[model samples]
Target chain A: MKISKEEVHYIAKLAKLHLTEEEADKMTEDFEKILSNFDAIRGVDVEGIMGETFKTTEAPHLRKDEERVFEDKKKLFQNTLDLKEGYIKVPKIIE
Target chain B: MTITIDAIKSAIEGGERLTEEIILQFYKRIEEREPEVNGFLTLCRDEALERARSIDQKRKKGEKLGRLAGVPVAIKDNISTDGMKTTCASRMLEDYIPPYDATVIKKLWDEDAIIIGKTNMDEFAMGSSNENSAFKVTSNPWDTKRVPGGSSGGSAAVVAAEMSVMSLGSDTGGSIRQPAAFCGVVGLKPTYGLVSRFGLIAFASSLDQIGPITRTVKDSAISLEVLQGHDPMDSTSYKGEASSYLESLEKGVKGLRMAVPKEFFHTKGLDPEIADSIRASIERYERLGAIVEEVSLPLMEESLAAYYLISSAEASSNLARFDGVRYGYRTKEYEKIEELMEKSRSEAFGKEVKRRIMMGTYALSSGYYDAYYNKAQKLRKIISLQYQEIFKDYDLIISPTTPILPFLKGEKTNDPLEMYLGDIYTININLAELPALSMPCGFSKEGLPIGLQLIGNHYSEATLLRAAHQLEQEIGLKSPIRKEEV
Candidate 1:
């Protein structure tokens, strides 16, 4: 419940969000209040209950394994912020 | 009087009013009122008119019309609209136009429902009020100074203001119902998996379901009929047969066993007027020969904590795809790919969204997973089972849609926990994967609308709508919001 600014920054880093010092301070306060509220779940007695996974009352329907090409490749790629040679341009990750 | 979807259909089919004329009339209203309400993020007036013209031509050619012919609908910004900007009211996707339509959008088009525009919402459906929208704050139609409970705030506001007869909104944790309650209209969060989530901008994927906001229960039923069905595109889409919601809507709630959860009434900060209104509505059900009982839901206390953890965790995962490389906004300055993603997300996402992602990241972090995320999931199962146990004996559960009436704008903006606590009555339904709806029950002393919620078992939309329809007829609090000429 008592989330420190360092912990807040670490989480933000994991989430790929950059936070300024001021924002980190504010988020730390917000998280402490919210997590303290969330801390109420810790006292819950889940002795016999299973943690929910992908279980449904009815069997989920699986679609037929078929491949169809999307017709609008031009429109699809148009949303790319930077497109060159039909590939999205990004800062080199492996260099 | 409000123009129901049925009225619109009849008038258009009977040639009393042209589809084009109906579209134009609503557009005129939108032009007059939308500036003040800020309900719409984007308006497609020309395309809507073009669609209306085509529908009219089909009618003139003696072709059979779709069920919702000539009806105009506003969509929440989160739902995909091919070629139309679907911003999610976030700076992140400010210019993003989806290349393909959402399953629900395609269904709307099939029904001949004209898509007038995209309505505003909380950025990524993260906030309880529309104030979180990056572009503008959507004002409540009843009281402009008050917040329209959100993240479907604009979807509810447009219908309440009669700018659109119906709208589609997504509910993760009462996003659709709460806003509808605040705006004095009908909002239904259909049973999860009952409606396809394909092309919905994901926010807590398991909990999120698309539903309708409308002026009448009948309209909500009809909208659900169009929106609900199996979609091969979404793997989680329900394969089970959905009931004919509109057909069974008039059957009434006679002999139906209803449960009033005692915990909902006892929640802190529940307005006395709203509680009285909910109790009065329950009495109306009893008067209609329905057996109503007060039951205990012991797990209700921890629902908020569990819901927040689960939703935020799923959101953090789902939203990870929003890096600057593909679509959406990109930061101008970033030397490394890592910096690019971090900077873009931090620059574009609103305060609440960042907080959620951070919280989720922490919960799912190495050491805390068992303590936080896993615990929340366990709590979710327990809470969900508690509802299932209650439903074994009761056909419906009734509660206040919102514990408090709509508050003034910026009143709770600084306090996230305060906003989260207001959702106590509505979040548990999402966790339980049940269908629930909010309809205007009465008005408070200040003349703001108070909402009563009716909840039903999974995929039981027909029963939920039927009971709401019956009560709508008996407790006729007609036009609780101030009706401006539109």
Candidate 2:
């Protein structure tokens, strides 16, 4: 469970984060200690238990898929840092 | 010494427009103690005063007010407030004013509850101690040196210090109850899905539940009446008739079968005094005519590990939304889009939040998913099944709300694992999605409070409230330290 700097960077990259050397080193140690603490889960004998995705007794009820519009689209659009027309503006992801 | 909601309610009922008077009374206390306590991040002074004055003017017009008329309530920073900043105690959302209010906030406004302010908390509700809050540390009201256990420390401390009549807090692995216990208030983590979670900043979505932190057990019951019910916005929110919690609260605990989970007593960090206090609460229940029995939840130890894995894994995905594109902090120096997101998140999220996202990212990574995340999921079922079996025969379960008393600020901050263990007795209830409550049962020799956690089966809040109400009468801990006491 000893996390290397490379592994920490890889995980951080996957999480869409960049880290300073100090934070990366600190996180490397943290991941090791936390993951070691989590080893206790491996000791439990839960051989055949079925996973309950959401634990509520009632199943998740989804609203009917309809073309309903939001009354506050302008308000919702206002939170974005950059807006073009009614949509959020982000830096181009593709060439 | 009691600060019940009834005082404000009764005054307004008698046609006295005391909204300004009540808000100002609590406002005076906040001005006095807030610097020492460090409870609130943003005080809604002008807005709250305006809202309270309007309510008073309406009262003069004989307009009917909602159940909570002009009583100010503190909100933990994570829950969304439309015009006010809901930072979740992180720099990322430091000035992020949500477009709409959380369902709970809207409900409170409807009832004419004055919005006291947004209180400080562990950033993203990530830490056990309030120290993780990027803004400030909320101290235990009883002993200013000690922490008001988090991640809802601010909410609990405000209620304990009588800054607000009641407050709202979201619990993900003991956020609400542990703070309530540490600060000597009644905090409830209601049944999962009982209260809607439309606008709560996500922290382990499945385990995250919003509940009240109040000065009294009955007030906790009364607040739940306003907080629960169906929400079309939240698909997970329940659509069933929940019991009338306030009415059923007066039902005595006679003939009720209560279980004291045997495993919780021997939890590694269990302080001797906390154990003794919880045991005494159980004995008192017996003397009051409820049958108390000791039961074992064999998967108790494993539940903590599962909680971290599942919560962290979920947090990894949920928190990915904080990328600089839409709202929150964005990096100014990044040249590329990916670089912008990466640097923005890295610079914005605190150490603990980063650690969780990294751990979660690792857990959900290609090779580790089955061994870590999926295994935790399987183990969750085993833990829930154990509680389900025990609940069929027992009316309720009880345990020490936290393994240890409120430690001094910065005591466990350096060691995240040590901080994580503080929720040993409280995390599994969230994992099992059961409703539970914590109330001040006793005090440590130093006078820092000890809380007794009363747990109930799913949607059994009425029964849990009844037992808590009965215990409140029996124990009668001096709650809501008055302005003079401070």
Candidate 3:
């Protein structure tokens, strides 16, 4: 269960994060300790238990799928980092 | 002594005190104690005064006032407030002013509650101790040297310090109850969907819930009345009748069936004082004619691992929205879109936030999904079924809110596993998605407050509040802030 720096780097990359060498080293140790403790779960016999995906106390009652006007459209657009012509500007994706 | 919400409401109604004067008095206390406690992240002094004056004017005109008329209430940084910053105590949302109010905030306004300020919390509600906050650490009101249990630390601290009449806090695992226990106030986490989570900043959406932190059980019950209900905005909001928590407050715990899970008493690292306090509280319930029994929830041993895996997995997916997108912080240096997102997240998120994301990513990764995520899912069912069986025969369950006393700052920051293990007592309740609360039972020899948790079945907030109110009367453990005044 000892996680390596390489694995930490791999996980960080998937999580859209980059770690310094020091942070990766510390994270590797943390993963090792936490995963070792989590080994306790390995012994539990969940033999006939069904895995739960979505947990809700009651069934979700969906609202009507109708569009409604947002009165404060201007304020909504103003919070964006960059707004150009009513579109949120971001790093260009097109080549 | 700290002024209770009941006192303020009656004073306003009886023409003895103006709401404005009461709000100003709370601000005076905040000015005195906030520097040392670090509870508030943003203050709304001018707006609070204006609202208080309007409330007074309405009373003068003989108009109907809201339940919380003129009461100044603090909100956790994660809950959105219209035109106010909801930072989640992370640098990413440091300056993010939400355009719309959260459903709970809107409900508070409708009830005539004054918005005092947004309080601090752990970054994205990640850590157990308030030290993980990117801005500053919130100290325990009882003892400034000890850490305030978090990520609802600021909400609990402000109420305990008499800075606000009540505060809203979100609990993913034990955020609300743990901090309330440490700060010696009352905290209640209602049944998962009983309260709307429309604008609560998502941590683990499935497990996350917003609850109240208050100075007394009665105050906690009243706040829940104002906060809970079905909201069209939140699809998962409970579509049932909201119970009258206040009407049942004085019903007492007589003839109630209470269960003390055997495993909780023997949890490793549990402080002896906390254990004694919880046991003593159970005895008090028995003395008041409660039929106390010992029950076994053997699956409890596996709860912490299940909680961490499931919550972290959910958090990893939910937090992916924070990638230098339409809002929040963006890195200044980035060439490509991917680089923009990666750099922005890495630069803005704190250490604990990154750690959880990594853990979650690792758990949900292709190769290890079954061993970690799926296994945790199955364990969740087994654990919840165990509680379902117990609740069928018992009216309530009791345990220590936190296994150990609040530790000093930096004590467990280096060892995240240790901090995670301390949550053993409270994490399972979230897995079951039941209502539970924490109220001060007694104080340790060092004068640190100790709390005992009372748990109830789904949507049984009225029952839980009734039992807790009775215990509050029996134990009569006043707020540590009041002790200071005495």
Candidate 4:
């Protein structure tokens, strides 16, 4: 249940979040309380039950594999924070 | 003219009130109260008025009208709105406007339901208290300083405050139900997959089901009639044949076998008044000729921990799409793409969101997955099976919707665990993928509202709403918050 500040930063990194020194300290404390609550699950014994990934009952519907003709691409491109001529712009990849 | 859905619909059809006039009337009331309650994030006044005018014109031209013709409804910010800002109450997507409508939004429009605005909520639908909203904390209309329970706080608050007639809210662990309980309104979390999740801003995918928050149970049933069904866009959308919720709404609880979970009654932090009110509600059902009995949920204690693990794990995955490239806020000063993502997320996400993400990532991390996430999943199966057994003997399960009454704005904001414990009663239903409805049962000694929850098996929304409507008719606590007119 106890999480160190270093571990908090590591998990935040995995979540693509960068915590400040203050945030990390506070998060470590929050984690202690939260994980302790989550620790209650440890008391539950699951010897026979299968792990239920019970997400959805609906089977994924398959569509015809044929390709469709092109439509205007403006809607998809509109939300991009940065875009160029018919392409999305991202930070430079190579030196 | 009355503001209730049934009354309004009749008035619109009777020519007693035009759709445009109805829109303007609600807008006038909303504008009067928005400054105090902070219920709305964005108001689509012009667009809503235009829609209303069109509906009136259509009816005048002998055109067939939709069931919800000219009724105005608010949507939680997390549900997508085409050409309107869908902020999710996060700085992360503060300026983001979705290009396509969410499946529910399209359905609402098809029914001629007017979209007035988006209601504020906890960031990414994460927190129990509305204070976690990055923009502004929404206040309970009943008490200006108290919270409307979250992450659908504003959605519920608006209905309670009479800012809107009804609203759409997504429930992941009692977000919609608790807020509706606090605000003294009717809220329903339909069976998981009963409604489409096509364009919902995903929080915990498996648990997150979009439902209606309304002033009356009948309105909620009608709203569900429009909101439920299969959609190809959302792979998990239920494919069952659609049925009208109106069919069984007036069917009272006479001879209905109801179970009151005794284990949930006197648990820690439960307000004594709230507990007594729920007991009284059960007694009322008995007086109405229903069979009520006390039952037990042995695995009730393990629900919260398992809920957090699964929900946070799903949230961590669902929220990963908020990187700089596709949409939403991007860091202005990151040289590398990874840095851009990290900084954007860190800056954009609020405290509760960050905590959940970290918790999820830790549980899902290599060494801990089996111990935490996997254990929780097995517990989920156990809990689901136990609920299935209970439903075989009982038509519905009843309990206090939340352990505590609506707290003051900053009371539990500092302690995440305390805020989380508020969801103890409501979370297990989501885990079991059952339909649960919360309606105003009574008020505390101090006059804040308390909710009684009625839960039913999968695809049992009709039964839950029927019980809620029956209770609503007998228990005549019409929100005292609306006592003072705008």
Candidate 5:
């Protein structure tokens, strides 16, 4: 249950979060406390129970696939933080 | 005038009051009380007034309006509304206005319901109290220093304060019920998939449900009737005929079997007064001819562990979309793309949110998925099966909604363990995907409200509402005494 500084860094990298040394040290303690709490569940026996996904009595409804026309292009860009040539701009994935 | 949904609807139809006048009243209340309560994140003054004026015109012209016509309603900040900023109480999405309205919001609009405003919540619905919100903490109308529970704190606070007639709140691990309990209002977390999740900002997709928080049980039922239904857009929505929850409100508990979990009653740290109130409620139910029995949920203790694992893992994935590149707050002065993402997320998200995301990432990592995430999923099944077995013998399970009444703000802010324990009685219901309702049953010695939770079988909201309504009538729990005049 102990989260080392290295493990905190690893988690941060995976989550795409950049933490300072002080933040990492603080998170290490928080993570340790949370993980230790979760460790309490290990003693419980849960054999032969199938994992349930979404709960519903009926099957999911499928809509007929059809081409739908877009009515509002200006509205789509109303909330965009960055836009260029009528398209949302993002950090370049490929350069 | 009564602020309940049924009363408002009756008044509007009877021509006793116009929709415009109702909206004006709500605006005045908000203007007077919001400085102290911090209930709403976005108040739709112009749009709400316009809609209300239109409804008034229709009434004057003798045209029929929709069921919820002129009924002012508040929406949780996480639900998307077209052209309005849907912050989810996070700085990362502070400027992110959704291009499309959430399915529930659209339905409310179609029903001619006036969208009064968007209420505050835990940032990304992550915390137990409203303290984690980036904007401001929502104060309980009952006591200004105490927190209205979260992440639906603002929604419940608004309903309690009479700032809005009814408000929508999304429950993931008792977000709606806990807050409603704290604020002394009625809150419902419908059976998972009973309501559509389309356009709801994803937190834990499998567990999250949008429900109603209102001043009365009947108002909660009427709001649920408008909100619940199948939507083809959301894969998890239930495909069945929708029932009128309000119509089933008067189906009194003549032969209903209620189960009180011995484990829930024996839990340590439960307030003695809260326990006494719940016991009193059980006595009332017995007087009403309902059979009450003690039941044990053997797997209940492990629910919090499983909930943390599953919810964090899903949240890490769901919140991954909030990169600086998308339609949200982005950091400046980053040299590389990696630095850009890292800096933006770390700077924008709160401490609790970051900690959870990191924990989730580790749980879902290649080396530990089986030990943490997968094991939690298997434990979830066991918990659900336990409920299924118990439901065969009883129609509903009853418990104190929360162990403690609403604590003063910052009381448990530094102690994460203490905060997580706030959800002890409620998280198990969400894990089992069962419908549940929280209603004010009694008042604490300190005058704070105590709520009794009624957990029901899947799609058994009608029975749950009926039981809660009957108990509400018998006990006559008064509304949380407001600190500030509305």
Candidate 6:
């Protein structure tokens, strides 16, 4: 499969990466080769097999929802680099 | 003192060596070799010494000591250790310290194993060579200019350099085995869910498994004994009785049926010397009274493709947590949330990581999801079912752990596809979710080590180790040259 530059740009945008033109060109070649190799899977016949999403034997046991609050939010917030008013601050999404 | 885990354990138990002394020796080795090899990301010197001294005190009091008590083990940087910098060899987590230990780390501490340091890895375990690490490239101890195959390169290099008795490494595809093969050490990637993944920084979660990199198969088995079992914290952990991996070491492969898939051997781009060495190892097994045969796995060729698609898709989602919002590095300047995520990821993650994330995001995107992600998952099931059928006919399968020997640093960095090809022979085992061990079988003319891989049925780590240990004796290859030579 030939990967177009526009497709590469879209992928980079979705992945939150700002790739230079040189990087995108290189990635195009890599993506093409990797996709070609994967084309071998197209020949395999898997009609009735069920999809194995996660390697779990049974459904995950969910803990009952409770209104427990963390007493020490300080440690949790310690690693955050940007904060304002006890909440993690990020670049404004609003225009 | 010898740095193998078994030797260190014996010396400590025999009253001839103190834990403090062994810990000091490892520190000295690190001080001497780490500058050239770039093995460790963070050295826990004071803490290791303190733990060692406590173990010595326990010995003096004649208290019961754990099997691996006092042994210094290096952990791959991705596994979390409380109060220690678990960077995953990426700039994103450079200053972040985990408040709790990973389940594997807690298990090792409970077994009395002292953590000497956290080792380097490919940033987020994305690349095949250690050169992708944001910290530094880990050189093969056998040859300084070449790579210690990655992303678990640092863990394998420490064992090869005698800086640590044993090390823990994670294998998503061929991270653990490829490095162990390159460095001429024993690496075991146990069956998925056999060892808990709790505390391992997620990278392709369904495929990721933590296992041992050691000098000998017995040592690998012993380490697995401590690392395996159910963990309530990791929901994917196996819920069955854990076997004594060490107890079955002496059991020979008398009647075991070993298979060699013809496709694995006859594949293109395989080095001639590596193929011959693997063939010779198979002969040795046949001589040991095991029935060897060639089995057909037509679906094996598609495994690498399916693996990359599934793994990349999962990695994109898994790494989404590092958006500079919760923890780790955050961009100081940005105009919007989208800009913050873009700039932070681009600045903190390496090129290879970004490439994979981009590929994964594309694979999982709206129009392409069916053609890429869904198809890959269906292919994964076919490949797995093929293994189930093969296992019914064969007790184990043997092949070259890696198709090629260690290459010089930067050899394939620009050519990502070439780098991915290095993992061709071993990734299938992970795709099938089976246990596999990579051990030194022979050496290249350049004197670089070549490894033979043994893939086993589910939970058949004991039998796999027995075959590998038997071949280890038969081949009698010298350990990788000391770090000073390179």
What C-alpha root-mean-square deviation, in Å, does candidate 1 show against the real structure?
1.4
| lDDT at residue B343 of model 3 (Cα atoms) | 96
Query: For this target, which candidate reaches the highest DockQ against the unseen true structure?
Result: 1
Residue B347, model 1: lDDT of: 93
Cand. 2 Cα-lDDT? 0.88
What is the C-alpha local distance difference test score of each model?
0.90, 0.88, 0.90, 0.88, 0.87, 0.86
Candidate 4 residue B379 Cα shift, in angstroms, is 0.4
Residues A1-95, candidate 6: write the lDDT tens digits: 56898899888888888888998888888888888887877777767766764342333443445676756677667677778899877656767
The per-model DockQ list reads: 0.71, 0.67, 0.71, 0.67, 0.59, 0.56
Question: Residues B1-486, candidate 2, lDDT per residue (tens digit)?
Answer: 466788778777786547887788889989988988999999978899899889988888999988998878999999999978889999899879898899999999999899989988999999877998988898888999999999999999999988988999999999999999999999999989999999999999889999999988888888999999999889889999966878787778899999988888877879999999988888899999999998887766577788999999999999999998889988888777998898889888998998899889999999888888889998887778788999989989999999999999877888888888888888989988999999999988988799999999999999999999999999875854553421
Better of 3 and 5 by DockQ: 3
Instruction: List the candidate 4 regions with Cα displacement exceeding 4 Å.
Output: A53-72, B481-486
For model 6 chain B, the run of ten residues with the poorest summed lDDT:
B477-486
* Chain A TM-score, each candidate: 0.87, 0.83, 0.86, 0.79, 0.77, 0.81
lDDT of 6 by residue, B1-486 (tens): 335667777778889988898788779878988999999999989999999999999889988888789888999999989889989999999998887789989889888899999999999998878999998989999999999999999999999888887999999998999999999999999998899999999999888999999988878988999999988777778888999866777778899899999988787789999999999888899899999999888765577778888899999999988888778888878887888888888899988888889879988999888777888888877777778888988989998998888999988988887788788887777777889999998898899999889999889888998888888877764755443311
Error of 5 at B474 (Å): 0.8
Model 1 ranges off by over 4 Å = A54-56, B480-486
Colliding pairs, model 4? none
Best first by DockQ, ranked: 1, 3, 2, 4, 5, 6
Please give each candidate's TM-score: 0.98, 0.97, 0.98, 0.97, 0.97, 0.95
In model 2, the runs with Cα more than 4 Å from the true position are A52-56, A71-74, A84-87, B483-486
lDDT of 1 by residue, B1-486 (tens): 568888889888998889998899999888888988999999999999999999999999999999899999999999999999999999999999899999999999998999999999999999989999999999998989999889999999999888999999999999999999999999999888889999999999889999999999999999998999989998888888867887787897789999998888888899999999999998999999999999998766588888998899999999999988799999999899998998999899999999888888888999999998898888888777788899999999999999989999999999999999889899998988889999998999899999999999987788999999999989774663455432
lDDT of 2 by residue, A1-95 (tens): 46789988888888998888988888888888888878888888777776665364577789877786768877776667878887777777788
**Each candidate's root-mean-square deviation in Å?**
1.4, 1.7, 1.5, 1.8, 1.9, 2.4
RMSD of model 3, in Å? 1.5
* Candidate 4 local lDDT, residue A87: 80
Lowest summed lDDT across 10 adjacent residues in model 2 chain B is found at B477-486
Candidate 6 TM-score, true structure as reference: 0.95
Question: By summed lDDT, which 10 consecutive residues of candidate 5 chain B come out lowest?
Answer: B477-486
The docking quality of candidate 1, as DockQ, is 0.71
